[model samples]
Target: MGRTRAVALVGMDAHVVEVEAHLAASVPGFTLVGLPDASLAEARDRVRAAMTSSGLGWPQRRITVNLSPAGLPKAGPGFDLAIAVATLAGAGVCDPESVAAQVHLGELGLDGRLRPVRGVLPAVVAAVQAGRHRVVVPAGNVDEARLVPGAQVAGAVSLAQVAAAHGAQVEVPAVDPVDPPRSPEDTPGGCDLTDVVGQATGRWALEVTAAGGHHLALIGPPGSGKTMLASRLPGLLPDLDDAAAVEVTAVHSIAGTLDPGTGLMRRPPFEAPHHTASAASVVGGGAGIPRPGAISRAHRGVLFLDEAPEFAPAVLQTLRQPLESGELRLHRAAGTARYPARVQLVLAANPCPCGNAVGKALDCTCTALARRRYLSRLSGPLLDRVDLQLDVLPATRAERRAGARESSAVVAHRVALARDRARARFQGTGWSTNSEAPGAWLRAHPPAGSAVRDLERALDRGLLTMRGADRVLRVAWTLADLAGAGRPEQDHVAQALALRSRTAGPT
Candidate 1:
């Protein structure tokens, strides 16, 4: 008998799976039991070729390898190394006890080399949390695996090296370590706020969005600085705390977007998918099990949808669930996977299909009906979930030439201060921003009677849904924080109502 440990990733969550092997004096065949996806099931040939290349002869007897917790669906080639090590132990080529205590994670190449696999960071975290701190990963993943505190990590370059480390008398070959891929911010042009020349309303909305972790929508024609404002929103946000850093890093690891060499991701992430992206790619879907989508990758960060109207309606509608709950629940045929999706969604769109419908509509080409249908692509329910909706008007030449409008650094300072106020206000609530606070909690701690009057009237007039009313209150609280007020006053509520009711194009 031989046994070792590996991690099976289900969305953002990871589980430690025990890999056990049994040898019998019967037909010389290899049998892999337990539920493994197609990629994992193909590990048989990979392991065989790797062992043969390493001079580790295959067992002549019937070899049976079972991934315990047989019901847990395992996928990917990450389990190949664990399977190979366990098989060698059962074949008596390596001491079983030597490998059983360590968690093995890597893909076995046909040439006996160990290849780096995604999700090593989360796997190591799970291994350490499970009280099994010893982890053996590929050289390329060593930096990421070591990020987990109290984890004993070893980087092996080849199968022979791992086998030799586990008491097998084998000569390990020297090979170059695999390098991790870089994850550039995808920030085209630049990521500075000053690049946005004008649109005072747009900049103010961005500040409020960042300060409270709220969703925003910017409507206008082309070259209106919508994308520029949206991209700079992440800059105004503060760095991720320790807990959030680990969580955000884990999501990127699972999504294969994190660069392990950079260590933990401290800055907030930014994900902007194209409009033509399918619902599965945007909302998190796959064949057997679903993986993290753009929203999940943007966890603890921002998800910008440029050209929002062009996106599939199905894809846009799917965001309503995560927006309401801050969690992505992807149900597939095999199992259901959950990922954190507490993101600030930023949307930018043209007022008309012709890209010329602003101001007096002098240059506009689309008909009234066409313009109405254009903006209507963004559903009312979806818009209601958004906290800030502002139109980006064409910047005047004077505004463009204005000397040094507030830079990202200046605005980020104010945003940080405002966020600090909100954090102190909700100290023990486990929520960091105004947007995250429960509506019931907000109602429980109402600001003032007069302040509530206008909001109540809006609700009574049917202008605001029950959900929209709560969101308005949240925005009012954020406004109060920005103004250094003790609580939202009538003026703050009025401003919030105005910000919420503003729209572009027809409606």
Candidate 2:
């Protein structure tokens, strides 16, 4: 008997899987057990061909490989290396003790090469968390595995190299290092805040959104630069910190969207899923284990939905949970996979179906009911969760032709500074951003005294729900942070009220 280890990704989390192999004298056959998904079950053929191609002999007796905790559902080919190594150990081809000490992650190609598997970062993270110090991965995934600190990672190209590294008397092969993926910042012709000709209010709202990690909605006529503002939001945001970058990278890794060359995703990610995306695609679900969707992909970043109202009502409504909780949970028969979805959602929609309801230049062709029905697609519940809902109009000729405005860099500087202030205030509170701060906590520590009079007035008039009032308080705190105020003043609360009022009615 030989035992080794691998990892099973349940969402972005990794669970260490024990792989045990046994050889018995019987009809030559290979049997893999322990509830593997289709992809993992096929590892038998892959491991056999890879071992043979690497000049390793397969045990001619009956072989049984079991992924124990036998009831746990395992998917993906990540277990291939572990299964192969354990089988080799069981056959006396390598030292079982050496195999047992290291965590193996990679898919085996029929030609003896190791192919990069998804979720390497999280798997390596799991290894470290589980107190396993060594992890073997494909050469292409070396950078990602190394991102996990304190782990001794060895990157190899083929099964033969992995075998030799595990104490087998086999020759090692040399492979060139793989290049990292290009950063979004390096991509030319990117959108910038300067490209947005006018709408000072819209730009300010974007800044506030970035500063507080708040969700926003932009309602306007077509060609009003709604998409432009949403697209450039990432530019105004700072790079992810070490911990956040690793978490974001781990999510991207599980989704198979992590660029090997990009290493850790320092820049805040930006995901703009078309309105046609399904609920599963937005919140994450599939045949086997649920995968991370657009929201999770946009974790710690922006998730922009262009033509927001055009999305299916179900899809639009599905965001409410994650918006409030900052985590998306997909429940399946297998289990629940929770992915961090602390995404700053930016939703854009036209003022009307024809998108000509706004601006005096364009005659209002849409009927009153037509306009109402269109905007109503964005349910009140969904709208309430959005912190900054602004009505964007076409830029005036004067504003468009005005001298160059402040660039994303300038706004980002202010945003970073404001974030620093917020971080300082939230030092021991466990809340990193105003949006993440609990309403109860904020209320208990009320921002000074009479500053919330305007909020009370709105609540009295039914203009704000408890949730809305909580959100207004959060926005007010953000405003104060941005202006470097000691606390939210009456003016800050008033400004926050006005911003929320913008999305209160149908145009």
Candidate 3:
């Protein structure tokens, strides 16, 4: 019997497991008797073929391979390299001690080639967290495997290459520092803040929302440039940091959305799934262990929902908890898996059943009751959580003739300055933005010149709930930061309240 190291996923976490292979005189068939799922059960034939094709001898006696901890379910072909190495060790073809210190992950091709597996980044991360110093992955995944700090990654093209390394007959190729994978750049946004010829109110709302990291909803008729406005939001956000990049990449990796051969994702992900998407697709749950859905994938970025009223209520309701908490936890019989969801939500919708109701040139064709019901899908609680609600107006002819507007680089610089101020203010609290400040923290450090007595009066009159009051103060803090004011002023407090109490606006 010989043992080798492998990894299996348990929720979002990867755990190391020992793959033991044994061969003895008996019937000349092989069996993988472990808690392996169907995919692992089918590894037997592939392993045999790969061994033979790699110029290694397959055991002609009874063979049994066990994956421990036998109670945990093992899935995927990632165990292929480990199983192959164990077989060679058990057959006295290689030293088990030499390969025992590393974790092995990769799928085997029938012709002795190694194929890359999904979730290599997470697997390598888990191995690193568990104190493993080395990892062997498919050559195709070498770039991802090298992302783990302090871990030596070896890339192999085929089973023979790995086996040869284990026998001390050849050197395992070291992973090269290849450029990380990145998201494909879509068509550049042609609209910008300066392109809108009018509706200064709506532009101000966008500025506040961007500065504060707040949720926003734009309501107006068709051709009001609501869609165009939402499309430009990524332009106004700050660049993602290293930690955020790893988190976003991890979510994409679990969703199988990571582009092959790409090593890092630098841009903040923007997910705009169609309105017809299922609740499971939006919130991240399916037949097996749930993977990250759209919300999680859009972490630290934008999640735009255009034509918002057309989406299912179930899909819309699933966002409530995550929107407030900045994280989503999928609960299942197996376990609870949490994914970060600190996204800047941008919802664009018309004011009524017929978008023409709010258009200047078109008369409403729908009943008032129908209009009310159409917008009612978003509950009052949900709207209250949204810090900015702008009534976008149609752009004037002058705006369209100006051609494509400001680039993302210009707006990103301003957002970064605001972010830096917020960071300095919230240092030691683990908050990067005013929108993320805890209620207690806001109460303890109320914005300077904010009338605490008046805020108390508003709370007493039911104008503001405890949560709402805290959020209002957070927005005031953001306004102060954006204006380069050391302390929040009275006008900033009033403007913050105006942005927060958006329900008072006309329909």
The TM-scores of all predictions, comma-separated, are: 0.95, 0.93, 0.87
lDDT score at residue 16, model 1, on the 0-100 scale: 95
RMSD of each: 2.5, 2.9, 4.1
User: Which runs in model 1 stand beyond 4 Å of their true positions?
Assistant: 181-190, 447-450, 456-466, 503-507
Per TM-score, the best of the predicted structures is 1
Backbone collisions counted per model: 0, 3, 5
Q: After best superposition, candidate 3 residue 420: deviation in angstroms?
A: 1.4
TM-score of 2: 0.93
Rank by lDDT (best first): 1, 2, 3
Per-residue lDDT for 1-507 in model 3, tens only? Answer: 777888887546677888898988888878787654666766888899988877787888878888888876565327888998988888777788877777888888887788877677777888888888699988777877787678799988888888888883433443332222444444234545666555556666766677788888888888888877777777677767888888777777766677755566777777776799888878788654677778887888888888888889889989999887878888765556677888988888888877876645268888878888977787553676777776776766675465655554666676778889999988888877888888888877876644676677788999888977887788788778878988677777777777665432321
Where does candidate 2 clash, by residue pair? 180-261, 181-261, 181-262
CA lDDT scores, all candidates in order: 0.86, 0.85, 0.76
